[model samples]
Target: MNSTVTMIVRLLLAIILLVFGANKFFNFIPMEAPPEGSFMDALIKTGYMMPLIAVSEIIPGFLLLINKWKGLALVWLAPISINIVLFHIAFDISTIAPAALVFTLNTFLIYINWKKFRTLF
Candidate 1:
């Protein structure tokens, strides 16, 4: 893709990540309580792990926005995507669509930045 298109995609992804991450930290978006006995409920039950997850999301979101650490951001973001996908899948497929989309986007980003990723190996 052209630099312009790449830049736009990157910006869009960064904005989405940052917003979602901040929501995790601040609950800026109202979230319905997960159903009892749900996977999300299990996640919530993990003391302190929630904030760490929030930080993981927020940190990479900020880094992606800066655009200088695209590779590093993707490295951080990949597992996040995986976790999200798994969480959603384990919980309910419908609830996981967003995570799937984000995962797909991350996969594309990784593919697009393959050169940078390859150099690290």
Candidate 2:
């Protein structure tokens, strides 16, 4: 992708990560409770899981926003994005759009930066 498109995607992903990540801690954006006995409910019940996820998101978000260690940031976000998509697909299909966006953006970033990551193989 061109630099402008890459930057836009990075910024969009960063904003999304920051907002949703902060929400996990502050609950500033109201959301419906997860369904009973669902995987989401189980995750919330763990107490630490949500905060951990918040940190995972926020750190990479800042990295992406600042255009620092972006390859690493995208790598760090990959699994979280996958889990987000999988969770939505399995538990709550109605809210899958954001998850899909995250996954797509992360995947695209990773693809464009594949050269930086090739040495790891």
lDDT of each: 0.82, 0.95
Off by over 4 Å in 1: 119-121
Please give, for residues 31-110, the per-residue lDDT of candidate 1 as tens digits. 89889987678888987777888788878878878887888888989988998999777766787877887788788888
By summed lDDT, which 10 consecutive residues of candidate 2 come out lowest?
32-41
Indicate which candidate wins on TM-score: 2
User: Distance from true position, residue 117, model 2, in Å?
Assistant: 1.2
Q: Show how many residue pairs clash in every candidate, following the order shown.
A: 0, 0
Candidate 1 positional error at 28, Å: 1.8
> For residues 10-80, what per-residue lDDT tens digits would candidate 2 score against the true structure?
99999999999999999999899988987889999999999999999999999999999998899899999
Best by lDDT: 2
Q: Which pairs clash in the backbone of model 2? A: none
Error at 79, model 1, angstroms = 1.3
Error of 2 at 113 (Å): 1.1
Judge candidate 2 at residue 66 and give its lDDT. Answer: 96
